[model samples]
Target: MIKQVRVVLFLVMLFTSIVLLSSQTSAAAGAISWTKPVERETKQAIKGGTHKKQEFAFGDGDLYWIHQVTAGQNQQPYVVTIPVKGESATFRYRAVAANKQPYWAQVSLRDVRVLPAASGFLETENKSVWLGKPIVYAALGKGTIDEKLTLAPPVEVKKTAGGYVLQVRLPMRAGLISEMWALESAEPLVIWGKESLEQIWLTLDVTDQAKWLYDGYYYKSPSTYVPYTETSYWRIPENYVLRSFLYTGGSKAALDMGYVMLKASLKQQEQQGYWKSLPRSQWLQNDYGISEGFYDTRFNTGAAGMMLKGCALYQEGEFCDAAKRYTLFFQQHAVSNHYVVEGTRPGWLVADYATVGKKSNTHVSLNHQLAEINYLYSSYLQFGDPTDKDLADIMLGGIVNLGSRWIVSSGDLHYAYFPNGTFGRTDYPYLTYNDLVETQRLYKLLHGMEEPTIGKLMASKLAWMEKNKVAYLTIK
Candidate 1:
C-alpha cells in the first residue's frame, strides 16, 4: 500500500513539472517587446529632415535597432542592426500616406539573406550603389489618382562601419512607415503569439498590387464593375488575379480568395460559353472606336485557360465543366460559323473579335493568335482532344508562314495584321514573347521537338527588347 501511494505521488509531481515547463515555453514564444526612439535630432535640414532610432526585442531574445533618417527628398536611409542571436532574420516594412494625397516609397533591404519571403521585384543589374547585394525592393504607393504609378529606380545600399544601412526613398509627401521583424526561418502562416507573419507569404506588395481585389472588393459584389482605368473596369483579367493567388504558395486565405474569384468568373460566362468584351461605351470608344458588345478571342482564351488551371489546382469539377463548355463553343460555333479569315498561309486565321449581332472583326493580332493556340494546345493535353491539337498546329503554321510580314524593321513583331494587309500598332514587348514561350513549351511537350520559327521569333523579340531596354513599358 505504501509503494502504491509513493508511485501515485511521483506521477503527480511529473505531471506538475511537465505543466510548468509547457507554460514557460509558451510564455517565451509569445513574448514581444519594443521601444520607440528615445531622441529625435534635427539633421542639417536641407529641406527639413530628422534622424530617429528605435530598438525591438524579437521573441528570440535578441535586440534589433533601426536608425532612420527622413528628409523631404526622394531618398531616405534606414540603418537596421542585425540580431546577434540568430544567423538570419526577416523584416517587413510598410509605408503609408499621412494625408489623403498620393504617397509612394521604395525600400531596399541590405545585408540580409534574400529568402523567398522577400516579396518584391528584384533588380537583376545593379542600377544604383545600394543595389549591390541580392537586392529585393518593394515599390509601395497608393492613391485615388487614375494615373499609372511610375516607380523610381531602387536606391543604393551602403554598409557603414556601424551596421547595414538601407537607402529608402521617401514619398513626395509625409507618410508613416511601420516595420515588423521575425526570425529568418520563421513559418509565415504560424502566428507567433499576437504577431502575425502572414505578409511574408506574399511575393508582392499586397497593399499596392490589386489591393481592392485582395481586400474583398470582388468577393463582396462579384458582378459589380471596378474601375481599372478611366475608361475600363476590366483591364486586369480574373484569371490573372486567380493565378497570382495560386502561385504565391497557395495559403488558405489565398485559396479562399481564389475560389471566390474562380466562381465569380464562372458565373459571368455567357450562355454561349464566351465572356463578352467590355460593353462600356468609354472603353469601346477608346479601344475599338465602336460601342457594340463583342466576344474577344484573346480574353476568352485567357479566362478559359485560367479556369482549366483553377480546375486542376483546386480539383473543382465545375471549373473543368465550364472550361469544356468554352472549348466546345470555340470548336462548334467559332469554327463552324467561319469566324476566321483565309490567310495566305496554310492554317485558318482566327478573328480577334466576334461582334454581337454584327460582322466579326477580322484583325489578327499576333498575341491573340498565339494565346488561342496555347489555350487549345493546353486543352488538348488536359482533355485529350485531337481536334484541339490539330487546330493549334494549323494556327501555328499560319504564324510561321506569315513570319517576316509581322517582323518590324527593328526585329520586333508588329502588334496586329489588319484585314487591309497592313501591320500597325505595337504590343507590349513581353506579352507576345510570353505567349510564344508557352506555345514552344507546349509544342515541345507534344512533339518532342522545338519549332525553329517560334524560336527565331522569340530570339528576335528578346534581342530587340534588350537592345532598346524596354523594361516596364505598359502601352495600354
Candidate 2:
C-alpha cells in the first residue's frame, strides 16, 4: 500500500513541474494569442450583385479582416499579415474581381489618428484625418496617383472595442480587377505588450524564404506579387534572394535561390552580356518598367556580387564563369576614375541618363560603387585573384572621394547617395531598413579585408537602426 501511494505522489509532482515549466516558457516568450474570429457584414448592402459580402476580422493586437464577397468562389482575395514587434503592421492583400469589366474597390480606415490632436474627436480635412497632423484616410494601392487602385484617400477608420477598425476599400479597374487587385499596406497603429511582435516572429517558419521574401518586401515587384517595399523601386532580382539569404542567416535554401535568380537574370542579359535593368518580360508587361528606361549601375554590380556570393556559398564552378564575365565587363566600362556611369545607350550600351529625365545627367552612384567593390572583394575571396582585390581597393578610393557628398546631418550618414554627379540635389535614397541591412552586409564582407573605416560606418548605421527599432533580425 505504501509503495502504491509513493508512485502516485511521484506522478503528481512530475506533472505539476511540467505544467509550471510550460507556463513559465509561455510568459517568457510573451506570446500573442488570436481572438475568436468575429464575422461582420459590410456597412452597406451590395446594390446589384447576387452575392452578399461579409468581413471576418481577427485580432492579434491589430485587426486583420478578410472580405468575402463571393463566398462560393475559389478566387477570393489573399491577405497575409506579418506583424513585427515595432514599426508598421504589414498587410498584403490580393483582391480579384470576378467581372471581366473594369472593376474597382476602395479600402478606407476612418476615425483614426497618428497622435492626439483633439480630446475625443478626429479632425477631418478633404477626406484626411488629423491626429496631431493630417494624414490621408486611406492606405492607397502601390500605383501612380491617377491609376485606378492608387487613390489619395483609401483608408477609413471607425471605433472598435478598444481601438479602431481600419477599412481599406480596394478598387480594381474593369476586366483588370483580377490582375490588378494586389497591394501591401503598412498601417501604423500602436499595440501594447511585447508578445504582439514575438508571437508573429515566432510563428514565422525560418525555412520559408519565399513567404518571408514576399512578406518582407525586400525586393520590388515581378520577383514577388505584393511588395514589402515601394513599387517604383527597381531592384536587381538577386537582391530579394540576398535578403532571404541574410534573413535566414545564410540558410542553404536562400543561397540556392540566390543562385537560381542570378542564373535567370543572366538569361535577360543583352547580346553584349550586360543585363537590362528590368527583365524583357517585365518591361513588356508593366508601364513603370518602361518609364524607368534601361540599365543602371546598381543592377549590374549587385547582380555580380550576388553571383560571387553564390559561388562562395555553393562552391560551384558554374557561377565562377559568369562572375568572371561580369567582372571583365565592368572592367571594360571604367569611364572616369574607375567609376561606372548610371544609364546606357542602345548600340554600345554607353552611359547616358539625360534621356530619362530633363535634369538627370550621367554620374557615378556611391551605393553602386560600393556594390561593385563588394563584388570584386567577393570574387577575390572566391578565386584568390590579386587583380580583383586591387580593383576593389581602387573603387573604394572613388567611393571615399565622394564621401563629402553623403547626406550627413549632425555628423551622421543620412542614407542617400548621389546618383547624379556630386552637385545634384536628387540623390537616390533607400528605405530605412534597406539602408541598415545593406550596411550590415557591407560590414560582414569588409570586416577582415583591411577596411576598418567602412566597417565602423556600417556599425554606426546598424546601431542607429537598432536604436530606432527598425533593425529586423536579418540585419542584426
Candidate 3:
C-alpha cells in the first residue's frame, strides 16, 4: 500500500508541474486584447507629447468621438487620415487644456452608413476606412478583416434592474488582425513603423473583477440613443447601464423631450419669474418618446433644459432664474459621445451622453461641440462649478487654435466649415436645422462669462437674434 501511494504521488506531481509550466508560458506570451471602441467622429483631444494615430471605420450618420490623449491640460494637435472605400480624407483635431486636454480624439466619415453587428456593409474585394480609402497590405497579412469586424458574434445579454449588467472576458484573437499590408498592395496601406499600440487595432472593451473602464481615465459616455447601431455602440449600455442587452426603446429616461422639460419647467417657474417659453411646435414638438402623453415646451428643447437648470441657481429674476434652471437641465442631458447609428429618422440623430460633443439631429463637427460647450459654460456661471469654466475655455481655445479650420459665420462667432472658410460668406445662407438656437445659446453662454471680448461678442449676437425676431434663445 505504501509503495502504490508513493508512485501515485509522483505521477500527480509530474502532471501538475507540466500543467503549471504550460500555463505560465501562455501567460507570458500575451497581453489583453480588445480595448474600448472609442474611435468616433468628434473633435479629438491631443496630449502635448509625441504619439501615433489609430485608424478605424465608423457608420455613416453624424460623427462620434473616441480615443483619449490627455497631456496635462495645455494644447496639442491630432491629425487623422480617414480612408473611406477608395478615397482618403484627413482632418486635424486640435485642443487646448488648462491642466490636461479634458476631451480628445475624434473619428470622421462621409456619407457613411451602418447596419447591425451580425452583418452590414462589406464588398467582395474591399475594406475601406471612413473615406473610402482602401487598406494597404502588409508583408505577412491574413487578407481582410471586414468579415471579422462585421460578423463577430456579440456576447449575449439580458436586462435587469439598476441598468444592463454584463461581465465579459474577450478573446485576444479578437483584438488583432494578421498583418496583411503588402508592399505590392495598391491600397492605401500602412507604412511600417506607424503601428501604434496606443491607437488600439480593434475598438472593443473587456470587463473583469477588479479594475475596468471609467475608473481613472478621462473619457466620455455614448448617448441615450443611437442612429448607427453596432454591437460596439450597444456594448456601452449593455455592460454599464444595465445587465441586459435589449433596450426595447424603454429606457429609464423614456419621456419624449417635451415631457422631460415639464419636470424642468416646474423648477423653472419656482426660480425664474418667467413661467413660459414660446410655442416651438415645428418638427417633433408635442411628441414624447412613449405614448400619446405630449410633453410641454418648457421641458424638452435645449433652451428649456438650460433655462430650468439656470433658474434653480440664480434665484434672481426672469433672465437669471430661467437661464440657470434650464442650463442645468441641458447639461445633465447633453448627448453622448457616440453618434453613428444604423437606422433612419423616427430614429433621429443623437449626441453623446456625459461629455459635451455633437448631439444628433442638432448639427455636426464644431457646430455642435462648440454650442454644447457654450451651454455648459452658461450653466457654470449660473451654478457654482468653476471647473466647467475651465472645460468651456479649453473648447473655445481649441477652436481658436484651429483658427480657420471651420467655415466662416454670418454672425458674431458664427462660422462655416468648408475647405478654407470660403464656403459661404453671406450669413452661411443655409443655417443647418439646429443652427440658430445653438448659436444663440452660445451668445447667452458667453454673455455670462467674465471675459470682455467674448461677452461683448455674445451681447452683439443676442442683439442680432432679437433684431431678426429669431426665436433664438427659447427660454424667454
Candidate 4:
C-alpha cells in the first residue's frame, strides 16, 4: 500500500513540472526584446547632453522606449531603432510644444520600406509631395528629393538614399490637437544581421500633462482640467471640447475635465454675461480677415449654447444659471443695441463681431447667423422663452430669403455677406450644412412642419460635396 501511494505522488509531480516548462517556453517566444544605446553609442549619435530615456505603454500591452533630446542653441538629432519581428510593425509619432510657440523636428528612418505614405493637405499653407516607391529610390540615388511630396499635417516625408526623411512643423498659436499619427513598415530593416535605426530631433516639450496622458505617469494630485501652465491653448476651456465631453458620453476623466472647464468659463463671465476674446482666437480670426474687438457674437453664442447643453445633459443648476444670464443679455442688450440688424426682408441678422459701446461689424456671416438661430431655438425649447423662438425664427428667415444668393457658382455657400451687398470668400464646406440640419430639426419641433428652404439647401450642399468628392475641407 505504501509503494502504490508513492508512485501516484511521483506521477502527479512529474506532470506539474512538464506543464510549467511549457508555459515558460510560450512566454519567452511571445516576448519582445527592446535594446537601448550604450553611453558610448549615445554620445556618438546625439549632439546634445539633455538626452533622457523613458518607457511608456499606450494601448493595451504595447510598450515603447522613448529617447528624448532637447534642442539648444542648435538643432539636435538622436538615433532611434524599431525592431520588426513578424511581417510588419507599426508605431505612432508626434511633436509637441512647451507653450503656444512654434517648433520643428526632422526624422530620418533608414533601410526600411515604409507603407502608405502620408497624404492629403492640412488647413495650413504647406505644400504636398507625391513620389511612388520606385521614383523615391531613383530620385534619392540621383541626390535630389522631389518637391511634390504628399503633405500630412504635423509630418511630411521625403525619400532619402537609404530610406526616408520626414519634416514636421507646428504652427504658431494655432491651438490644434491631432489624432495619433501612425507610421507602418512592410518589412524589417536589417543592416548586417542587425536592426537598422532611425534618427529624429526631439524637443523638450514634454510636460506633466503630456507625460500623464501618454505615459500613464502618476501624479500625487492632478488638476480636474488641463491648466494653462501645461499648454497655452487651455487658457480658456474651448467650447468644442466641452461639447465633445458632454455630448459624446465621454469617460469619467473627460467629464471631470469638462465640468471644471465649465466652472472656469462661468467665473470668467463679464458683468454683461459674455466672456472676453481670447488672443489665440483672434489670431485664427485674423487669418480669415475677421476682426474681433472686445467680444465676438458668434463665439459668445456658441459658448453660451454649450453651457446650456451641459445644463440639460448633466442637470447642473450652475450651468443653467450662466446660460440664462447670457440669454437675458442677448434679449435685452443685443436686441436693443443694434447688434441685431434688420435685413431688407422680414428677417433679422446677428452681427458677426462687436466692440463695446459701438455698433457691431457690418458683415453678416452665414455660419454666425445659423449658429445663433440654433442656439436661440434650443434656448427656447429648454427655458420655454418665447423671445428666444421669435429671434431664432427671424434669423432663420434671413437665411431663407438670401437663398441662392449665398450659394456660390460652385454650389458652395459664400463665407460672409459684406456691407457692399456682395458675398465673398469660402466657408467650411460642411459647417453650414450641419447648422442648417439642426435648425431644420428645431423648426420642425417648434412648428410641426419641415422647413423646405433649409431642406433644399442641405440637398444642394450634399450634392456639391458628392460631386467634388470632398469628405472634409479645413478652412480654419
Best by TM-score: 1
Clashing pairs in 4: 128-149, 129-148, 129-149, 129-150, 130-148, 130-149
* TM-score to native of every candidate shown: 0.53, 0.41, 0.23, 0.50
Minimum summed lDDT over a 10-residue window in model 2 is located at 126-135
Which of the two, 1 or 4, has more TM-score? 1
Which ten residues in a row are the worst by lDDT in model 1?
126-135
Candidates ranked by TM-score: 1, 4, 2, 3
Ranking by lDDT: 1, 4, 2, 3
User: For residues 1-476, what per-residue lDDT tens digits would candidate 3 score against the true structure?
Assistant: 01121232232222222222233224312222212222312334333422222222312222221222223333422322222332222211222247532222332222223211111112112231111111111111111112124322232222333222211111123222111110111232222123331111111112111011111100111122221212111111001111110111121111111122222234435232223222121222222122112122212233343343324322324434555554444433332322332222111112312112223222223444454555556567556677556555544554444343233343434433232223222222122213333444454555553443333444545555566665332223
lDDT of 4: 0.46
- Residue-level error in angstroms, candidate 4, position 14: 63
RMSD of 2: 19.9
Ten residues in sequence with the least summed lDDT for candidate 3: 237-246
Cα lDDT of all candidates, in order?
0.49, 0.35, 0.28, 0.46
Q: Pick the candidate with the highest lDDT.
A: 1
Judge candidate 3 at residue 178 and give its lDDT.
17
> What are the RMSDs of all candidates, in order?
21.3, 19.9, 28.2, 22.3
Q: Across residues 1-476, which tens digit of lDDT does each residue of candidate 4 receive?
A: 01121232232222222222233223322212222212111322234234444433322222323333333324322333323222211222233457643233222233223433322111111111211111110111111111112222233434444334544331211111111221122211111121111111011111211111111111111122122122222222224434444443213322333454465567667777776553323332443343422456665786797688667655778789889988887765446433333454567666565555565545677776887888888899889989899878877877777777777778877778766567886766455666666677779889999888788777788778778875532211
Predicted structure 1: lDDT:
0.49
lDDT of 1 by residue, 277-333 (tens): 443334433445445345667667867976886676667788889999898877754
- Candidate 3 lDDT score at position 463: 57
